[model samples]
Target: MRAENTQPVDRTMDIETLMRALLRDVLGLSQDRVDAFDLDTPLFGALPELDSMAVAGLLTEMEDRFAILIEDDDIDGETFETFGTLLAFAEAKAGN
Candidate 1:
């Protein structure tokens, strides 16, 4: 397995800010709701809109926005169980 990257991003880049942006842009959630979410909150369980189609949209968004490649077999429900888990997965893919 490859080693995990731990370098920090630019000071202008905030993890929470990036996470909220991802939630809103990729998940089509309003800023209001996105802002109120806890780290452990289950995004799909909390929002009914995140079904199979939403997963496709999310994967597309990740590739476009983060330049993170997600293989077909790389993800399953467990990886998406919570907001923090999903964000961690993205952070790992981003090598950060």
Candidate 2:
């Protein structure tokens, strides 16, 4: 039998923290707003600041910050339906 090592890998930024920062920076939201974010928090339709234009900017910012490429076809209403969905997409792109 082989023994397995149990060391945790360090990630400079976790998905949730990164997502909150992204929302704050890209949407120009206050820290109070960003701090209230959660997996179930509505994003696209519910948030007044998250319009189509903001979505584009947010995606671009995410690509730059996370060093991940986001394809056109991958974007949709559902992708931004909630914070969780967006985080899932980012996490998948980051191979986390």
Candidate 3:
């Protein structure tokens, strides 16, 4: 007989904080810049650092940090349209 190991996931982790840190680290944005982002803050086209190439790295980091899998069809322009949209996408993918 073997005992099963069980541990509850920490759902209370603040996704917004994680996102702010991620954006700062991945995109090399200043802490002040990321901290100032509101729900309506534009991302992809509005930020010079968040170009098409950076999107790939951002997606990869999101997957690793959030422990969520993102498929090719799962993303579109709307996903990165704004800070709110990106947060919504992350919350959905993380099952939050």
Q: Indicate which candidate wins on TM-score.
A: 3
Q: Judge candidate 1 at residue 56 and give its lDDT.
A: 83
Candidate 1 vs candidate 2, lDDT winner: 2
lDDT of 3: 0.90
Q: Which stretches of candidate 1 lie over 4 Å from their true place?
A: 1-15
Query: Lowest summed lDDT over 10 consecutive residues: which window, candidate 3?
Result: 4-13
TM for every model, in the order presented, reads 0.77, 0.85, 0.86
> Runs in model 3 with CA error above 4 Å?
1-13
Residue 70 displacement (Å), model 2: 0.5
**Candidate 2, 40: how far from true, in Å?**
0.6
Candidate 1 per-residue lDDT, tens place, 10-93, comes to 622455577678778877789999888776989766678787788788788877777778998889777778878887777777
RMSD of 3: 3.9
Error of 2 at 18 (Å): 1.1
Q: In model 2, which runs have C-alpha deviations exceeding 4 angstroms?
A: 1-13
**Taking the tens digit of each residue's C-alpha lDDT, what string does model 2 give over 4-73?**
7664354524767888999999999999998988789999989999999999999999999889999999
What global local distance difference test value does model 1 have? Answer: 0.77
Error of 3 at 89 (Å): 0.3
Clashing pairs in 3: none
Cα lDDT for residue 65, model 3? 97
